[model samples]
Each structure stands twice: as structure tokens, then as C-alpha cells.
Target chain A: MKTITSTVMLASLFAVSANTSAATLDEVVGKGHVQCGVSQGLPGFSNFDDKGNWSGVDVDICRAIAAAIFNDSEAVKYTPLSSKERFTALQSGEIDVLSRNTTWTATRDTALGLNFAGVNYYDGQGFMVRKDLGVNSALELDGAAICTQTGTTTELNVADYFRSNDMAYTVVAYEKSDEVVAAYDSGRCDVYTTDQSGLYAQRIKLKDVSAHKVLPEVISKEPLGPVVRQGDDQWFNLVKWSLYCMINAEEMGITSQNIKSKMNGKDPAVKRLLGEEGAFGENLGVSPTWCGNIVAQVGNYGESFARHLSVDPLNISRGVNELWSKGGIQYAPPIR
Target chain B: MAKEESAGPPEVTTKPWNDPKVRSIFFQVVLLILVVLAGMYIFGNTADNLERQGIATGFSFFGTTAGFGIITHLIEYNEASSYGRAFAVGLLNTLLVAFCGIIAATILGVVIGISRLSKNWMVSRMAMVYIETFRNIPLLLQIFFWYFAVLRALPQPKNSVNFLDSIFINSRGIYMPSAIYEDGFSLVLWALGIAVVAVVVMTRWAHKRQDQTGQQFHTIYYSIALLIGLPLLAFTVTGFPLSWEIPALKGFNFAGGTVIIPEFVALWLSLSIYTASFIAEIVRAGIQAVSHGQTEAAHALGIKAGPTLQLVILPQALRVIIPPLSSQFLNLTKNSSLATAIAYPELVSVFTGTVLNQTGQAVEIISVTMAVYLSISLGISAMMNWYNAKMALVER
Candidate 1:
């Protein structure tokens, strides 16, 4: 009887440890797909089309990571998560990488046991109001009812903005971005505040998009990026370098169309980035042609921006997201 | 008592290992041990994983500043308040909706339930249609219909549908006049208190007098007169000390008066309407459970129809109704959590949704939210149980 009880206890211990012992890359490799957490639908970020295809800058990050690992951009499964559910989903290993439009903050980094891989998009909080409301600026929004998505840094930023101005306002927050837009469009709120890019994204969903205008005021800096669970250094480095590879490729004037011809080119930086020289891919434990795959499949950062945000409906200019050599703030460390 | 000789102890037919009582006890003990072991394993495993993930696990985060604004709060709340205060604000909002919903549902349910059994064919059919239309549809859809389809279709604040220039109904909310009291308000309050006490004493005296002399008193009429007359008299003497602050469109919304946010209105209306349908069926069943003979007997005694229902049938029917009615009340309270979908700022929406995200304390926040709902449900259950026992039939 004693021996039987001991055996049962040992078996149960194994079961407990089995659930918690995931090394994200190995698990992703074993499953043959990268599990990516993204937003429900933010037009230029991570949105699902009617054809069941997801496309955006954030979605491309996950695709880039998958391309680097499996050399197949489509080997990625997406889980659309709300802002309220995103952190828990990542912390519980429900997704290997959260490429949602998540702002990297100090408290989230240290306290939530998560690490920001790198900033994929630089953004700032701003407001959108009805052009008919005759409100030209955010400071004029005193006593205005504001609608925002809940469980975001936007709420805290708006609260601080109003309190410091000694203005009184009411916030009607919703859990989903769609609800916020619906509420704002129905006149439940006088002002809609979110990341400036998000405001533009959501504005397209409005009934009369021409009737609304985004305010000029940029309230706070929002460095949106991908996040991974803490304590997995290998997974963290892989994700970080995957994003850097895209930015580096953009800075080198390398386009997806030219990447095939550049395989035998002579430039040292191009050779190194395209995996012809050095042990960059071997160091990260991926294929030597990993960077080549990412550029060929998902394209460089500039290509993605032009494809998603800088085009027709969004019409966003690359004021700050341009490469560091091109008077914008985007900079990447050189890979030896 | 009859004297009897004590018999010796009964003999055991089999060994203790083969005895049924010993076997049952052994099995129960083993089952208990297994249950405890499983529970401990789950707890330990969760803790281990959480620690490894580096997610903070504690209630200390409650004291941290919440730094968020709520659309509506019964108590004072601001960005400066702690997460604990936010929890209370959410709890109070939930209770406000649940309490108002319970009262509204019960009144509407009792009316519709009786209407279904009315002698008039049209009234009974309409009530049946009402019950079927509402109960058959899902509650969330009803809430969306009311919130998005009905309320959202209303005009904005600038073109609010005004009622007498004192009350404004718009897509934002219903804004009405709020009373601003002067110094002599206390005198009016005292007078109102005295009137209530006098009415209670008069009711008891009337009951006792009727028991002794077999005569009835118009106690309700007297109580109403006292309640209204005393307050009005106090008001006149105090020179009409109350002034009204009517809401006017100041900026984006109406300001300077009591405003009811549309989220609350939408949630309350949907929950009450949905729960009332179920309650109507329960109430109808309860009334039918009372025999037709009881009504006949009351009529045979020359009692009027209203009096028959008030005095004879309802008193007995309540024994059946109260038990199920309590369950409906509990359901309404729990269903209020769905307010999160519509942004009502209730307990689950404000605390569990926002606070959990801000603090990243899912383990602690979720458990606290669950405990709060459990306690609220238990409190409702205990109150209903007490009332049920009081109204229960007493037999000698």
C-alpha cells in the first residue's frame, strides 16, 4: 500500500510540471506554427478581412518571426485578443508572442513578467472629434464626454491630461474598439481618444468619416511593439532580431523584389544581412537564410508600412517611422 | 412508562473488516484524502507557474491609485482614488441596478402573471404574448436592441427631446431636475419621520381593533394622507425651501442636474424585462397551484373579487411563490455582470475588466471578483430564506 501511494504521488508531480515547462521556441517548432496574439481588428495594425486573412504591420511581425523559423510566412496561427485579455494570454503561454498594438511601459515590463522585444511602430495618443462639434483642439474638450477603450494607457493619459488642465470630463469606456467607435458614432461621447494611428484606423469605420477630424495634440508617447513572456532569453532574442532584421533591410534599400538578385552581391552589409557572411542566423539557432526569408516573404518594415498604413484609406505619412539615415527616428544596431 | 428487561448487546455476525459500517467509513476517508490531495496539487501547480512567469501575486495592489475615470458613480470617485475605491464604486453601481431591477421586475411580473389568468380574453392573450416575446429571446440581444437600436436612435443632446424644458431625454442620458435643499430641510425630514411613525402605530391599533370588534378601518387612506400632508405642511412652513436645478445643455452634455447615464438605463431595462418574463411564468404557476375551491369559498363568503385575491388566495399562494421568486432575484443579480458588455461600469466591468488589466494581477483580481459575487448571492439567499420561513404555513 505504501509503495502504491508513493507511485501515485510521483505521477501527479509529473503532470503538474508538464503544464508549466514550455520553452516557447521548441514548443513552436514542435507544433510547426507560431502562435501569435493580436488585436481583434485595428485596420493598419492587425485586422481580419472578410476572406479570413489577417494583414497589417503587427501581423507582419508575427509573419516575419514565422518566416525566420519555418521559412514559411503562413505557418502562423493568430489569436485575436482584447486589451484586457492580452497580458494574461501572454503570461499563461496561450500565445508564443503577442504582436498586438501593445504599448511598452515600465510597469508592464518589470511587474507583469513580460519583455518588450522591440518597438515596431512609434505612436502617440490623440483625440478625434466631430467636425460639427466645433471643437478644434483637445484643450477645448472641457466637460466633454470622452469614449475610449478600457484597460489601456490611454485612459490614464487622458485622466492626467484633464486633471492637470483643471478640466472636468466624463469617460465612457468600452472593452472593444468596435464598441467605442459605435458609441462615439452614436453621439454617446463628444470626443474619442486613442493612439493617433488607432484614431485614424477607427475613423474609417464611422458612418460619415468626413464629418470627423483628428486633433493636432499628441498627448503621450506610445511605443507599440511585440511582447513575450519573461525568462526565455532565446525566444526573446529571436523575436527581437527578427524585427531588427526587417528594419535593417529597410535601411539598406533592399526590397523583396531585389532580395533574390542580391544573394550574390558584393556589399559587406548586404551580404551579412542576407546571411551570406557571418554566423548571425547560427547564433540565433535559426537558418542562415532566415533574414532572406523574412525580407522575401513579409518584406521590409518600409514595404509593410507602405502596404498597410501609408496607403489609401489610412494615408499616414512616415514622419517618424522612416529609417534613421532618412531623418526619421527608426534605428537598428548593426549585425556583425 | 412500561418496565422492560434490558437485552444483552447484539452479536457481530462477521469480522470488523467485512462489516458495512467500517467499509463505508474507510471509503469516505479515502475519498476525502484524494480530494484534498487533488486540491493541493492544483494550488501548488498554479503558484509555481505564476512565480516562474514573474507575475505579481498579492492584494497589495488594491491600495495603488487606479488613475481612471468612471462614467457614473454613486459614491465619490476620481483618478486619485485607490483600486479598492474603484471596486466599491463598481459594487455600488451593480447593487443600484440589481435593487431597482428587482423591484421593477416583481411589480411587472405580478401584474402580467395575473393578467394572463384574467377573465377578459384580450387581456390574457396580450399578457401571454408579452411573456412569450420577451422570454424566448436571449437577454444579451434584448440589451443590444435597447441600447444600440432604441437608445442610439434617439437624437443627440443638442436636439434632445425636451419634456416641459425641465427634463431632457437624449442619446447621452436622461437629465432631470435635482433638488437643492436650504437650511430648513431638516425640519421637513423630521416631520416626514414623525408621519411615518404615526402611520405605523395607527396601523397596528387598527389591526387590533378590527380583531376585537370585527370592523374594518381605512388604514391605507389615513396613512397616505399623513405621509403626504405632514411633508407638505412642513414645506409650506419652511417657505418652500427646496429649489430645482434643471439640467441645461452647457457644453457637450446637459449639466447641473441629476443625469442618468444611458448605459445604466439600458442595462436596468433589459435585465428587468428579461427576468420579469421568467418571473411571470413562475407567478402564474404559483397562482394556479392554489386550488379553485379557495376562490369559490371566498366568493361564497360574500367577499369581493379584489378582497378574495388579497386576503385568501394570495396568502396561501405566496408559500409557493416566495421560494422560486428568490431564485429569480438571485438570477437578476448575477445577470447584472453582463453590464460589462454595454459599458455599465458595474463590478465586473470596472473592477475585473479594467483593474485586472491595469494591475496585471489576474489571479488576485479574478478571485476577489468571484468572492464578491459569491457573497452578494449568499446575502440575497439568506434574506429570501428568512422571508420564506416567515411566510411558511404554520401547522399545529
Candidate 2:
């Protein structure tokens, strides 16, 4: 009896320990696909199309990382998560990477046991109001009822904005983004607040699409990017540099269409980026042409922006999202 | 003979390992050790994982600022409060909704349950329809129906529908008159407490009188009068210490009166209505479990149908009712966690959802949230146990 009980106990303990191991670069590759956490549905950020294809800025980041690892963008799985479950999913090894539109906060960096890869989209918190309300600025929203998604930095930012301005407003919060829009569209709230890009993408879903205007005042900095669990430097560097390579490709005018032709350029920066002159890809534990794979599969950051947000569907201008060499704040460190 | 018995004890029947009693003891000791080892392994693994991930693993996050606003709170709260304060607000809101839901469900359940068993065809069929309609539908869908479909269809605050001169209805919420307590309100409240104690003593005396003299006092009427009369008398003596602040539409919302947010209304209504359907069935089963001969015997005496139910049937039926009713209460409290879906800011939505995100202490925050629900369930069971003891069919 004693031996039987001891054996059972040992077996159960092993069962638990087997599942508690954290994410590692080797584990992701061995699994044959990357597990990426994303939102349930957020237009132009990380949402599925009518044909069940994932296409958004955040989704592209996941694809780029997949391309870097497997050289096939389709070698990826998506786990749609709420804001509440996003971090836990990464921390518990349920996902290899959380490519959700998560902001990189100081506390999240130092305390959350997570590392943000890099900023794929630089957004600021802003408010959207009906044009009929005659509110063009957030300061004019003194007594307005606001709607926002819960479990987000936008909720706290709106609270701080109202308190600092001594405004008295009620908030009607919801868990899903569509619910927030539904509430606002139904006149349950006078204002809707989120990241500025979110405002631009979500405005089209309103009852009268052209009747709403985003307020002029940007409240707080919200640098949205992908995130991963801490303690895996190899995985962290792989995801971070994957995003950086996209930005670098854009800055160097290397489109997926032109990447193969540009690989023969004499510029040392271009040569090193394409893995012709250096072991940068080897340093990150991928194939020598990993940058080329990402570029060829998912295109550069500028292309993703144009395809998802800046073109026909969501015509959000690239104000602060442009590269530093241009007039915007998007700057990536040099490869060499 | 005694020497034989002692010598037989010394002679082992079998090896100690194979002996039944010895082996039982050995197995129990092994089980205890195994449980301890398993618990330690889990704890150590969790600690190691938390340390490696850089996530803080403690309750210290409760002391920091919450930096968020709740839609409704029973207690005072603000963005400046700590996460601890936010948790308290959430708990209070949960308790408020749970208590209200239980009271409403009990009243509705008993009424429908007694009516379901009615001999009248129309009454029974209507009760069955109500029960099946609510019980068959999913609760989350019912909540969404109330919130998104029913309440959101109301006109905006600027064009609110007036219920009366004192109350207003709008898309924001239902607004009504607010009661304001003045300086002498505590005196009236004390008078009401005194009246309650007096009524209890009077009830015991009346029971003894009936036992001895075979005569009944009008106790129900007497108790009601005493409970209401004393408070009103005190109010008159203290110069009417109650006032009203009637709701009127101001610039944006009705500012000075009490407002019930749409989330609370939807959650409370859906929970009470859905749980009432199940509770109605429980009530009917309890009534059916009692032998009909008991009621026939009461009717054969001088008792009417109303007195028969009040004096004989309900007391016997309570033994079956209390246990299941307690379970339903626990279910309601746990289901209150669904408040997160509608943004009600109950304990789960506020503490586990928002605070967990802000602090990034999923391990600690989740542990605390689970403990809260566990304690609530245990507390309800403890109270039910006491009631069950009182209702037990005691005999010598």
C-alpha cells in the first residue's frame, strides 16, 4: 500500500512539473509553430478578415517572427485573449509570445516579468466624440459620460485626465471593444476614449460614421508593441530584432518587392542587414537570411501600416509613426 | 490460561509489514508524507517561476494607487484610493447585489412555486411557462438582453422619460428620489430597534399563553403596529427627521438624486429572475415532499387553508427548503463574478480583472480572488447548518 501510494504521488508530481516549464526558443521550434496571443477583434490592429485570415499591424508582427523562425508565415497559431488574460497567458507558457497590442510601461518592464519586443505602433491616448456634441477638445468634455474598454491603460489615462482637469464625468466601461462602440453609438455615453489609432479605426463602426470626430487633445503616451515572457534572452532577442528588421528595412527603402534586388547593394548597412557581410542572423539563432525572410513574407513596417491602417479602409495618417529620418519618432538602431 | 494469552500476543501471527493494523498505520504515514511533499513541490515551483519572470509575488501591490474609476460603489472611492480600497468597494458592491438578488428571488420563487401546484389549469400553465422560459435560456444571454436590448433602447438623458414628478428614466440609468437623513434620524432608528425587541418578547409570551390557556392573541397585527408605530411616534416628537431630494434632469444627468446604473439593474434582474426559476422548482419539491395527510389533518381541525399553510405545512416543508436555498444563494454569489462581462466592477471585475492587469501580479491577485469566493461559500453553508439544526424534526 505504501509503495503504491508513493508511486502515485510521484506520478502526479511529474505530471504537474512537466507543464510548468516556461517558454524557450527551443520549445517553440520543437512545437513547430509559434503560439501568439492577440485580441478577440480590434480593427486594423489584430483582427480576422471575413475569410478567417489574420491581418493587422500586430498580426503582421507575429507573422514576421514566424517567418524569421520557420521561413513560413502560416506556421503560426493565434490565441485570442481579453486584456485581463493576455499577461497571464504569456506568464504561464500558454503562448510563446503575446503579439497583442500591449503598451510598454515601466512597471510592466520591471515588475511584470515580461519584456516588450519593440514598438510597432506609437500611439497616444485620445478621445472621440460626436460632432453634434460640439466637443472638439478633451477639455470641453467636462461633464461628459465616457465609454472605454476595461483592463486597459486607456481607462486609467482617462481617469487621470478628468481628475487633473477637475472635470466631473461618468464612465460606462465594457470588456470588449465592440461593446464600447455599441454603447457609445447608442448614445449611452457622450465620449469614447482609447489610443488615437484605435479611435480612427473604430469611428467607422459608429451609427453615423461621418458624424463623429476624434478630439484634438492627446492625453498620454501609449507605445503599443508585442511582448514576451522574461528569462528567455534568445526568444526575447529573436522577437525584438524581428520587429526591428522590419523598421530597418523600411528606413533603408527595402520593400519585399525590392529586398532580393536590394540584397546586391554595395552599402555595408544593407549588406549586413541581409546577412551578406555579418553573422547578425546567426547571433539571433536563425538562418543567415532571416531578415530577408521577414521582409519577403510580411513586408516592412511602413507597408504594414499602409495596408492595415493608412489605406482605403482606415485612412489614419502616419503622423508620429513615421521614421526618425523622416519627420516622425519611429527610429530603429543600426544593424551593424 | 492468562499465561497462554500473554504468550500468544508475543508470538507474531505474521510479519509486521503484512499485519493488517501495522500496515494500515504504515500506509497512513506514507500518505501524509506524500501529501506534504506534493504541496512543497508545487509551492517551490511557483516561487521559482515567479522569481524567474520578474513578476512580484506578494500582496504589497494593494497599497498602491488604483488610478481607475468605478461606475458605481456602495462605499466612497476615487482614482486616488489604493487597490485595497478598490477591492473593498468591489466586495461591497458584490454583497449589495447578492443580498438584493437573494431577497427578490426568494419572494418570487415562493409565490410562483405555490402557484404552480394550483388546481386551476390557467394558473399552473402560466407558472410552468414562466419557469421553463427563464430556466431553459442561458443566463448570460438574458443579461445581454436586459443590458443591450432592453435598457439601451431607452431614450438618452437629454430626452428622458419621466416616470413621475419625482423620478426619471434614461439610457444612463433609472433615477429616483433620494432620502436625506437629518440630525434626529438616529432617535427614530433606535425606537425601531426597541420595537423589534419588544415584539420578540411579546411573541414568546403569546406562545406560552396559547400553550396554557388555549387562547390566541392577534400577534401579527400587534407586531406590525408596534414596529411601525414607535418609529413614526419618535419622528413626530423629533420634528420629522426625513427629507427627500427628488431627481430632476440637470445639464447632463440628474445630479442630486439617487441613480442606479444600467449594469447593476441588468445584473440584479437577470440573476434574480434566472435563479428564481430553479428556486421555484425547489420550493415546489419541498411542498410536495410533505405528506398531504398532515395538511388534511390540519383542515379537519378548526384551521382554514391559510392557517393550515402558515402553522403546519411551511414549518414541515422548511427542512427540505433551507438546504437547497442556501446552495442557490452561493450560486448567485459566485455567478456575480459574471459582472465582469457587463462592467459591473464586482470583486472579480475590479480586483481580478483591472487590478491584476495594473499590478501584473496574476498569481497573487488570482489567489486572493479565489479565497474571497471560497470564504463566501463557506460562510453561507455555516449559516444554513444553523438553520437546518433549528428545523430538524426533533424528538426524545
Give iRMSD, candidate 1.
Answer: 8.7
Candidate 2 lDDT by residue in tens digits, A212-251: 9888899999999999877778889999999999999999
lDDT per residue as tens, model 1, A146-207: 99988999999999999999999999988889989998998888899999999999999999
Model 2, B172-281: lDDT tens digits are 88888899999999999999999999999999999999999999888999999999999999999999989999986665667768889888999999999999999999
Alpha-carbon runs more than 4 Å astray in model 1: A1-20, B1-16
- Please give the distance, in angstroms, between residue B119's alpha carbon in candidate 2 and its true position after superposition: 0.8
Pick by lDDT: which candidate is best? 1
lDDT of each: 0.89, 0.85
Best by TM-score: 1
